[model samples]
Target: MDALEARVHRQLERMRELADRMAAVRVRETSADGVVTAVVDGNGALVDLELSDGVAELSPTDFEQTLVSTAASAARRAFAERGALVTGFNEEAAEDG
Candidate 1:
């Protein structure tokens, strides 16, 4: 391959690796009182949730709020992680270029 073609090939490989890493991303967050736990995937979709018996003490509104907040926190963390991965990939690609 020509030099430019070789560079393109390398970048394609890096992109594939980045996609794999992003796909594997997962983040978990729990409420302060341990009543609620949430897990989110790279796309910030809630993949799992856990509730402790302590949740029984919460009113329906409170429980709903806590569950939403916990899931939001986990999704935010997942987004940050995915951003960092992309940033690192970009930095490496820049260096290569």
Candidate 2:
């Protein structure tokens, strides 16, 4: 293969690896009061939701807020993790190039 073709192939392979790694990432977050927990994937999709006994004592509005905030936190964390992975890949590619 030509040098340019080989370089393109290598970059495609690296991108595939990055996609796989990102898909495998999950971030878990809990509310400050420990009443709510949420899990989100690298794409910021909710994967799981959990509540503790303390949640039962919260008012309806508080409970709703807790769930929203907890899930938001988890989603943020997941995206941050995704960003880190992309950053690492870019740094490595830059160094290699």
The model with the greatest TM-score is: 1
Residues 1-97, candidate 2: write the lDDT tens digits: 6998999998999999999999999999999999998999998888888889998899999999999988998888888889999999999899879
Global lDDT of each candidate: 0.95, 0.92
Prediction-by-prediction clash tally: 0, 0
Candidate 1 positional error at 50, Å: 0.7
Worst 10-residue lDDT window, candidate 2: 72-81
Displacement of the residue 83 alpha carbon in candidate 2, Å? 0.8
- Local accuracy of candidate 1 as per-residue lDDT tens digits, 1-97: 5999989999999999999999999999999999999999999999998999999899999999999999999998999999999999999988997
Point out where model 1 deviates above 4 Å.
none
lDDT of 1 at 65: 95
**Relative to the unseen true structure, what is the C-alpha lDDT of residue 69 in candidate 2, on a scale of 0 to 100?**
88
